[model samples]
Target: MLAALIRQAQQAGLSPEPGFAPKELHWLAQLHSGKFTGVLPLREGKKGRQVARCPELSQPEMMALPRVLGQTQAAHFLADSCGVIALLPERAGQEVDAKTQAKHGAYAALLERAAQDLPQLLPVLEVLRNPAELAELRAELAQRGAKATDRLSFAVDGLDLLESELWYDWWRRFRRQVFGQPTTTGTMLDLSSGEVVTPAKTHPKLNKLGVGAMPTGASLIGYDKEAFSSYGLQAGENGAVSEENAAAYRAALEHLLAQAPVLGQMKVAVWFDHRQAEGQALIDAIENPATLTQASETFSWDDWDDTEAIQIVQTPEQQAAVAHTRAQQLLSALRRGETPPTLTAQYFALAISGASGRAMVRDWHTGSLEQLAEAVATWFEDLAITNLSGKRAKRPRFFSLLMNIQRPKPQSTSMDDYLKPIRNLQLPLWRAALDPNAPIPFSAVAKLMEAHKAQVMTGQFSEALSRDGDGEDKSRIYTRMALLKAYHNRKARRQLARGQGGFLMSSSVDPHHPSPAYHCGRLMYLLANVQDAQGSDVNAGVVQRYYGAASSTPALVLGRLTRLSQHHLAKIAREKPGLALTLERDIAAVWSALGHALPKTLSLEEQSLFALGYYQQLADSVSRRQDLAAQRKAAAAQADPHPATSPLAETTQTEQTAQGE
Candidate 1:
């Protein structure tokens, strides 16, 4: 039986590759089992070679060579090379031609049946018969004839056909296969009443079996040639019945409508139009009456005067009022922790005759109708129920008031206008606290206090107070001066407590005790500080004056002068006072100190500020003395001419004495 099977497979165009012959049916059995593996020689041109040891033979290629050669001498040669025992030709129940014809008839019948209900089934059936799947199908069909007629059986057959390797091979061959060729290895056949008509030899590239061609044996089974030609399918053109398809498609549409409540007490009507026109159908088979009515009406903006065709529900004035009321209500609801509901249209219509015409009812529901009603309700409910007992809401305090005072009003007249009125009034008092004798200029003091207050309020005073001279030397000097002035005020208050009232003494020339060297050093430091503040090189006279003054004065006075000069220089530097007057005063102070012994080790630059200070002091003293002399001369002129020289002088002396006391 196995030998007979092999013979039948051979005659039916089955063969194996070289170096793959059967031994006791091993090669034939292995080939049928799909497990045999070997190389097959392939050569171009006329070079003969062993079929084994070929570089280009894939496993499928090797397996297919024998099948292609069939029971011919080529099959025997290929089988010999592969070392497989060849099956000799033997009658296997029927002649090859007869068997081939029967298979073709079967295929033709399958194609006809596929074309009737589902033309998609033909390609699937072609797959089943290519690789001996017909045998299994035939056996299965024979055992279950009733089951084979069911849709599930067709699905199973389709899946099995797709899974088979023969399916892909047959699909390729079907595209290339020709009719009336005896050697064509496909099952498609023609069954006709007339003699088997031979096809004429035309262009090899022409696809005669394609749709719309004359009905050859292969084409006649699944399609009508006459009808295809009339429809232009055979003319290699598209059919002109697309509108018909659309009409048919539209007739099969289904409409879905939803009616739901949106908000708490309003109804929502939603109409979904899913109807489609199939083929050439102009109208949707399943359209809603309301939508169709609306679509049929023509609208024109210029037809407002046609009152019978255009009725107004709410006039423009009424609409504005309604909109305003709605806005107010929405605001009130938000304030009262309530969710606002949406307002939807009450009616819809075809505006054919007038806007007042009764609308067609498409869908209707009496329920809640707000867009975000649920979301709004949830938000308000969450807010009302949240537990916020221990959470402290921040409130403004005294510090906020202070900050508000310092902040400048936008349209101020000047710096004075910008400063708080009370702060401006306190400037003199602040300066008096620093030094009674060295009362700062009111404007300069106010500016300084404002800056200091800003720095303090910003929490920068402590850090500024702590920093010494690093790279920022000028800032260090300013910080030191501010601290020292603060210290001097404290010391003066302490002195006043002890009844030693010298708080108003001149910082330049006080003579009670030997002044400390640190005082002279501080004065020299201040001169340098001021010069640096002015962005200028040091002048010698300025340094000399301070050094000489420090040498003559008591330590207390020296210390006071040091602190005072530092404060005053910082003030002057920041204020940029009139330099002429300042320079004169400084020069006069240096000149007055010149009456004392000078330091031998003083540098020329160090002597310059002192010289300048002496000149300045002299100029001021002369100016004052000259003014006094002029006043006396004027008084004498105003007196009686050459009269009462002795008695008048005595009366004047008595009055001066009483006034001085």
Candidate 2:
């Protein structure tokens, strides 16, 4: 990983030479050598040292400027102290603080020394020397391309020396003549590049990782403890790399982190140095896969331009069409025992967080883009279920699955402290997504089970759609169902690996042939449906009231539920023949599969299957409704070649309904 990162840094032009591995320094050189016009001049506030403004320059030349003079610490001077004068006019207290007085004194001494050597900087020094003339000079500076927030630096000719030349010359001379070489404590093997070089005492820090990790940025690589050192080597020397290499890696990491997608504490980034284009395409493909073979216009590369802003028309039908296309393509490749070249690019992902002041690398996943796409395809297939609103989604993303555990706050990493226990499982879940063989973390599974059990016991039907009139956020039971199914499928694969019996993960309920636990689950849903259909205004149906008991101890719950269901069926048969016949046939088919009796009790795994069975049965209702609608449409078209539409047609509805609905 270190070598790969080093290579990436080299590709990024961060490390210019074997010995010289400067971070922003090399970046600065690139900006200067390139065609930049000017820099934004940020001025300090009148009250404190905060940047008050970085007003624009009128000159077209300045607009092209790239950022060269970036944030720097370590004995640096700014305009408030070094150039012109401090905004003492605005401060109520006239007494100069000791720190400010000392800083200005140093600046004055540096100017005097520079005046003695570099004669061209005389005018700039003259301006810095007078406090009485500072106000007029600052006004002039603003119009001349300096912002109120600018650190007053100089240029000789292009507005005189361009400020770049003045600062660059001074800094270069300072480095060579005064700053000299960085102090090196010991020579050690460079782990990053595999060479002997002087190691840095401490690595650079990782900044801007939301709040509460640490006030100061976290150190990416550190060794403060004696136990961390080897052979009596202190601090960073234990995993020594030259200061140059260290700087390079830190810079690269910082760059990647800046663009990474963050969710709560987790920050995620992906890379594919060798075939970046292909890898990005694969990522997009997995999100919206192509289910069809390539035709002349089977795939459109134009659809994947993230750099360009474009409006998308994403209707449900359009999304479903794309998902179908992607799935078909994936299935063909899997059947053929080959990975598509377009999807075979190498890929790597990193997930990071901050813990106190240290960086916590949550996950690092590496695989072929093909493997990733294939895994994603499987993930989608496993998660196939009707959402709470009775609408089908192609597949839920990793973040969507996470929301089932706990939702992230908008625009920030401020997850509720109460959710910390479950939030910690997010990393393992993300890893499980990338690798099919990897088991979903047991902790995460337990959390889901616990939450489900609680919901079941409370008899609160959570997944009321937005249109349900209650105006509550829909429940995540569908996603919970998907996750449990995926988990058990992986567990089953593990069984297969150990030369034991295993079950295939199903996309829909198979009443004809399902596990005994699945049958128990189906029975529960059936009982609930009968009670709902026969009764009026039942606040919570049988499944909602007793799902916990039925799932855990099926034999004990089923007999009572079965007796109540018989009463429901009898009433339905007396009142509604069409629905009654459908319910009766459905009951017989499922009961036939269950044989004579229900299982006595369910363990964790069986209970999970029970949830799947219930979810699948629920999802099947949507399919059955769609099929009924299609059949009606066919009959109407047959009766009249083109049926006339009217308000009457809108008012009318299907008389026959599915038992579950």
Candidate 3:
């Protein structure tokens, strides 16, 4: 990761070499150095005195300072910056002096040192020479928005002093000469750069830890507690990062924190690097995954000035199809072994979470672009489901897919334990989507079942049968169906090792062969349809009351439902004989496949199959309705002046679809 960050810095034309820092740090260093020259305000008593045109530190140019005890460093505006009394060594919240001094010569020596080092610092020296002059300078600087605690610098010759290479070099030398090596004893291994170098006392704080965190930032390598250490190494030495390498890595991570988008509590950053290092365009494309699908939408043709013209515009559906097409193309390239070294890229992703005043490393992954593209292609393929009209389902956003498995929130403010179970399910599911070979979590189906039961009971079954409804409602169904499919397909593969599984399910219901539970699910759907055919109010329908029981324990619920559905079928036949026969035929086909018997109870795996079967049967019912409606329209259009619309031609349609399908 450090190497990648260093590479990033170099690619952006930034030099974080021995004498130079990264761009932001360089700018900050310049803002605090004293070589800069600009308009300098005089003391309050000297208000009529012309503003000095010399090196001067202003409060607005300052940054947060590092804490250093028992040492004093004076800025260009030494007297102008108040709060120096607290930093003076001779004072400890005591009276200022016996008689003459209000500040008791506070920070006097520190100001004098600056004057002795450079005569250019005369303005500050003059102010410190007189107590009244210092008081006035403080008052004047305060009125101009100067803060006593802020680090101060100046603008010299129309440029920042720290921007001068001479000042950076001088400061580096001064620090080494004055402080010596931080670790007095021995050299240690630098983990980030993989070299032998003196380790730092602590890694620099990750600048701007921006997940709604305190700006004071966090430690990436902390060994403050004894249990956190090993082999007698103390503090950050346990991680053993050299001060230089630590700074570089922190800068890089800070860059990502500023750039990556945060979703929920996960902070994610991604980058694609090439071995030959010539993939700027590829990196740009990889950064915006949506662009992979909707390039024309993001890269507009009308606004484009490229030599090649983009003349065609595609609809959202077409954009989705195009994404799959591109994914497949990438896979085919790998399969054909047509990829060159230039086509190869390395992908890195870091998932971070900030909590407890520290940056937590949640996940770090590296993969080849080819592998990622193939996995993504398979992801979309595995997520595909059959809609109510027996057509392919559109791809769902990852966010919506994860949200479907999550239960509704608690009313109470406290829910930490409740959220852990949900988070456990989410992490593995996310990994499964990325690495196709990774197992779907063992808890996935069970948790989804829990959420499914809640949905059925809460009257949120907006599209329980039709499969496709309106926008967001349809998306939820599609995501649920996709997650179900992925889990089952993976479960089936695992079962193949025991010689207990043979094939995946088709998009529609299979009557030739199926588990008993699946057949039970089909029975449940038919019973719900029976209720609808009789125009019974579905507010307390068969599904609303008994879907959970019927799916898990068929013997207890199926028989009672069958008896109730027969009564419903009798009523439907009286009103619409033709529609009733159609319903009876559908039920009979499923029963015949079940060998005219119901299972006593279902196992856990069987329950999943039951859910899928119910969804499939519901979709088939919707397709049949659509086919019937189309047929009636055709007949009405061709018949002699519509022939007064005979009752036979006008078989009653269930306006009250099952569960509001």
Candidate 4:
């Protein structure tokens, strides 16, 4: 893996040499003939600051920048205030300690030493050595409103000292010599390269290779204790990777980290075979398959330009059309046994997280694109539970699915704290998406079950239209059902692979399912529907009153609810005999499927099945009710071709009839 990353870095045109790294200089110290001229700010007139020319670095230029790790008192040839100013600024409140004085001396000395081989650095070193020139540079910075602490690099006669190849070559050679020399203290070795160093006891820290997105001070490889170092290796000695390969590996990893997609606290980097254009398409397919389905028809590669100033706004109808198109494509593949085009490119993904200044490897996955495609297809196929309209619910992104199961937060909880628990599971779920054989986390299933219970018991159905005309969001419920269905389907798939009898759950409710728990769930939905049939809204409906108990201990709660359902059915019989009779027949069917008695208690998985049955049955019921209302409207239209009735009144009457009004 390390070798592959190093190769990727080299291919990406990153600096393959150990000493070269890019540094963002905020303020350029202008010079003329080795004399301090003025201070030029990089980000002037942009994002609340003023400057000229921006001074952006080209890829090659950035790679060629001289790099070094001067942690504290050790100063770089190009450095901040303490290294450039002999006397600290008063407003800056920086003390000119003995160590700070040493840094300024060291900075000038290094440049002077390198000036011999690189004459371009000579002018910059002359200005730094001159106390008068240094004071003038500081005063000029103050005049320009540049922060005293801003990073400073010299530009002599229109040439950036950092960009000078002579300087870069000289620094490279000096760094190699420094690392190769012996130290009085026990050696610190580079974990990736096994190169020895002094002062610091372990490898250079990670997270600095990229922007601040990577965790600060996180050690990807380190050994601080005696127990961790083995085979007579000294503490912090990395013996596995030698100096020859470490530099290349670190460079490659830094390139990957810079563009790696982040999810909550985890960073996932993907690398694909050279044949592939990029790994982003594969990642999008895994993380959000809906985007990949019918993508070519709905969008063009040219449509997304990072440099484009104006974003094209999509209408809701367009969004719906895209979703519908994806649904049709996925459904067609499943029904007609059509295969997706073969993907030959292979890819690798590494998931890492940081905590307490340590880097943790969450997961690593490597597979052909075909495996990923199939895994995603199977994921959606098994998870495609019906919506309120009884059509396949739109597939959700992996992140959205996880968000659905996120624990409910109190108003006092911060957004980050609320999301922490869910964030911790992102890597595992991502791995599961890329590997069909992997199991969905049981904790996720349990959380979904809890969310379902809360939705039902609180009478706050997601995207549900209740009898009282109260609107509630049902997206959460849909997400829960989708996950539940996939959970059972994957479990069954594994069982079948082992030659054990296991049944896959359907997207819609299956009346003849073998599990009694499924029928109980259906019964629960039917009983609730029976109560809903009553013209008047009840403050406490069957679901709100007993869903928790009915789902878990059906034998105890469902029997009582079943008996009470008769009273609910009887009260609505006079007003809407049709709806009442339909409810009666549905209840009987579920009871027959459930057998003579319900299960005494349901296990966690069985309880999930019960929730699935309830959700699917509710979807079936709502869909039928809507169809019945539509049929009534059509028939009434035929009866009165030009009746003097408002459409609103007609629709309201139709809705009332459907609800047994």
Top model number, lDDT = 4
Alpha-carbon TM-score of each model against the true structure: 0.14, 0.73, 0.68, 0.78
Give the alpha carbon lDDT tens digit for every residue of 243-268 in model 3. Answer: 66665666567666666755445566
lDDT of 1 by residue, 314-343 (tens): 785554333333323332344455544333
Question: Which one is best on TM-score?
Answer: 4
lDDT of 2 by residue, 315-374 (tens): 755544444454455444554565454543467787788888888777888887567767
Each prediction's number of clashing residue pairs: 67, 22, 6, 12
- For each candidate in turn, give its C-alpha RMSD to the true structure in angstroms: 40.7, 9.1, 10.1, 7.6
- lDDT, candidates in the order shown: 0.28, 0.57, 0.56, 0.65
Q: How far is candidate 3 from the true structure (C-alpha RMSD, Å)?
A: 10.1
* TM-score ranking of the models: 4, 2, 3, 1
Tens digits of per-residue lDDT, candidate 4, 20-92, equal 4444466777888777778777754532222211222212222233333232334555544523443445465
Name the runs in model 4 displaced over 4 angstroms.
23-72, 79-105, 126-152, 181-203, 208-216, 228-230, 235-238, 275-278, 288-293, 296-343, 415-424, 462-473, 534-540, 631-643
| Cα deviation of 503, candidate 1, in Å | 5.1
CA shift of 432, model 4, Å? 1.3
